[model samples]
Target: MRGLSVGLAGLAALGWAASALAQDVRPNVLVVLVDDAAFMDFGAYGGEARTPVIDALAARGALFVQHRTTPLCAPSRAMLLTGLDAHQAGVATIPEVIPPEHVGQPGYTLALEPGVMTMASRLQAVGYQTVMAGKWHLGSGPGDLPDAHGFERSFALDASGADNWEQKTYMPFYATAPWFEDGQPASLPDDFYSSEFLVDQLMDYLGETPGADRPFFAYLAFQAIHIPIQVDPAYTDRYVETYAEGWDVLRGQRRDRAAALGFIPEAAPLAPTPDRLRPWASLTADQRDLYTRSMAVNAGMLEAMDHHLGRLVDYLQAAGALENTVILVTSDNGPEPSHPVGEPGFRLWMALHDIEWRTETLGERGTTAFIGPEWAFAAASPFDLFKFYASDGGLRVPLIAAGPGIASGIRIDSPTSVADIAPTVMQLAGAEGAVADFTGRSLAEALSGGAPAVYGADDVIGFEVSGNAALIRGEWKLVRNLDPWGDGRWRLFNIALDPGETTDRSQSDPEMFTEMRAAYALWAADVGVLEMPDGYSVHRQISINALQRQLAQYGLLPGVFALVLLGGLGLGGYWLVRRMRRRRHP
Candidate 1:
């Protein structure tokens, strides 16, 4: 009887200690991820997008000046959530860009590898409620939804992107929009609009909580400013004349603002416009009108997303959970430059489906459009290139972290990766021990200005996506942009002094360049980065994948029939030509 009484007393004391610790720590975590936005698209970052909600967060938190992510969606999100390199997380590149030859390879699986720990799972193990809503592009197979990745409640879309106004796919890679609710296939409501519907679902999730004792991690990823840019008329009305000056002037203006705000050095030269980008003065009036309206819709979509975000902020405040919550806002990658409406195959597909794509209805429900490369270049002001390449513009993006412990109104200029987000969140939640698979360190101390540094000057970070490559160590960076946009020659630059990569110093400093090249070779081999075949490009790869899908659907009969019909037509044409020549000679 005496031993039983002592054991009961000991158990009671431990329970009390655990409860007390929970009460003393653990703030709710809210991560807001937007899609396909450039570094300066947010108002706080010096662009025309009216993101009041994000600007306020920047004012109240720390903005990371040199934050980088992969050049595309799946890889960036994989790193952000797992704190592992894109290859380490098993999403080396998006499924659209993965070559057929490398489809099932270790790093090209396009799914989270077994044993990879996600931030949600880590937090859930530590008594935090995990919830997610909006884009979840990681995977869509069994055991691949948000529930499998540690989210207890989720309403997610498992595609690169979807239509903002309906449950339809925005790209050719997917046949339908793959949406899942709590691990089961679900459908979107009839009244769907990307930003509004996402918040509505997330708010419903947050409101279902029983009490304030248990902290929650809510991840809201908006498909705003992505493909088929749709928004209310009011938001678009504000930017009708905003882009009239065109990309050339807008690029210079944004560069000046970045310098004034100390986002870039004043002496750093702006990158010369690429030869592919046509000047505004060379455009016809009709072309100018079409491009301007496209940009207007793009800006409007961004503001519409912010408007919906403000509603969520209001709800959290009304629930008395705003002040204690940690809010981190960032984009998956830089601006999207693909123009599907201009493609012959895409136009033919629309025609076959009886879909109408008109200029006046560009931002409407049935129409699909994109800003293409010219606007994407301007969106990434002062930087060299846009998304889908390994340039600074493609990798560089804005990151703002605001919460209970972080300093307000400050900018951290240190180099950080998207992978750092997971460890940083775990550190803030006091759930570090639950995570044992992180390849990134916490940036909490660095953001707070209380620690020395997270990365050493000698540490090398190598990045690759679809064979585009870059390696950075301290202030030096080595890059190789494949054929179309570059000469495929390795170039070195002092990025700290020239964020625009205006000068290549590989010829001037041979020894350092050699060392960095050797380091990149080792890193690539370790990460399972495979070589791209000769004459490969992401655009051509996408076409190949699309054609493959069509062939699989129709089988071998259609191809054979078409080939025979073409051969007969060729023979008939040759006979007709020969007869005409004989008659002329006679």
Candidate 2:
């Protein structure tokens, strides 16, 4: 008996030694997150953007056709980093659209709560050098920046978005573009462009620890294609005529291309264009030119982002780190539909800030532009609607994974969520023990071709933010979107057969709808999802919040003016009353 025990102990020690050695050679991780890119926005995904770098990655990596994320930015970001639901990570929704009743609530805190462990923190615990660059909208309160959330060296913008060409607020919601490096306020250079600066900062961080034996977990969150989209004219000039055909024709082209690529069924019906948008032919020539120029700029911004990303890839190759690095590229949500130019009082604000919206310089510095809803709908071809809704078009986006241990030239059609990203990264980095702490399952097997799918047919997943809700169970999806885009009712669709969500199966498949609806109710209760107040609209709430923030920032002068105007009126009224009384007495 004593001899047998001694042999078992010896085997256990050998296993531990083997694990330690394997951990020492774990692959470096590079997670690239783009803001508000649609499912078909990248060239590899059948869009007009000249994204050679990202396309090359897709060519040699796995591209996910059914990946879903929250419809909003901050919530999706929270899920991507923590491998948990948006609520579990303490960012139920973005501050810009958060309702007043839900503020400061348990899940709606808009910041990472205590005890939440991020991917960077977990990787750093196991000897990985973690760094980050670009947008960090997770939080802005005390200890809410990237440095406090496991990033070692970070140049993070702690807002929804800011000017791409300078350190200024893009919208009236912010007083300034709050940027920080290593937890201290950082300033930008005179020639700063967002995409270039973000990549430059990441390279500097990587170069600081040259030839280090330890691996790295670098997160590059680009603000490309977000609001105030700006890029060099050199990139924009190539696409000046690409969108002249307008959004309706572009929508059909994308849908056909998506079918050819096997992203959807050949017979899948395209979602009807919303009644709110005018037909392309009805628009005046000037309007068409402006819209066309805006889309060209959108493509240019994406291409510029790709060009800069290639620089980082080149740097990694030169340093011999590319061979053993795992690169995952994805977007936070679908394309943005908001057009600030059309909003009331927006022109005045633009003029006040020296922002121009001319066609000739659409994507240059000092210009603010967006693709708006029509183009956003076109960009999200073969699917319904765009961002800020729970429809597939808003939640479904592209995900590409490449590098060591990941199979090349693979396309994964299985349904996956952004929450699954952190666990997969941890698993690849040899931090498997920490994977159990997250709600998201690892996609390591799927990426390695060990399994065709991650979740079984019985598995259920639920997502909600600012009243936009969706639940998935196998081939069925239950979605409820409120206000502007949706009628505030639950609709069921078989996503496997209809990725476009053109047909509602609630009445046709009653049993499945009932079962899924009940399952969603249970999941929502378990997750502590708060019901939105009656008559709530995210768009309305955003305007309210923006106005409140603007008032708080620059209200004193306006307040004084209003007070002075009221005082003069009061004095005039009193004098008139006194004169009327004297006349009556006389």
Best by TM-score: 2
Error of 2 at 192 (Å): 0.4
- lDDT string for model 1 (374-400, tens) is 888988887888887788888888899
Question: What is the alpha-carbon lDDT for the whole of candidate 1?
Answer: 0.80
In candidate 1 the C-alpha lDDT for residue 105 amounts to 89
Clashes of each: 0, 0
What's the TM-score of every candidate structure?
0.90, 0.91
lDDT of 2 by residue, 1-586 (tens): 3223323333333332233225557888999999999999999999899999999999999999989999989999999999999898899998888888999999999999998889999988888888999999988889999999898899999999999989998886788899999889999887788988888788777655332556889999999989988898888888879999999999999999999999999999999998877678988898899888889989999999998899788767755668788999999999999877665456667887899988888888899989988999999898999898899889999999999879999999888999999999999888998545777889999999889999899998788988889999899999998987888889999988888888899999999889988999999988778999998866557666765666577687764442332221255633443344334320
Off by over 4 Å in 2: 1-23, 557-586
Task: Evaluate residue 108 in candidate 1 and report its C-alpha lDDT on the 0 to 100 scale.
Answer: 84
The TM-score of predicted model 1 comes to 0.90
Query: Which window of 10 residues has the lowest lDDT sum in candidate 2?
Result: 560-569
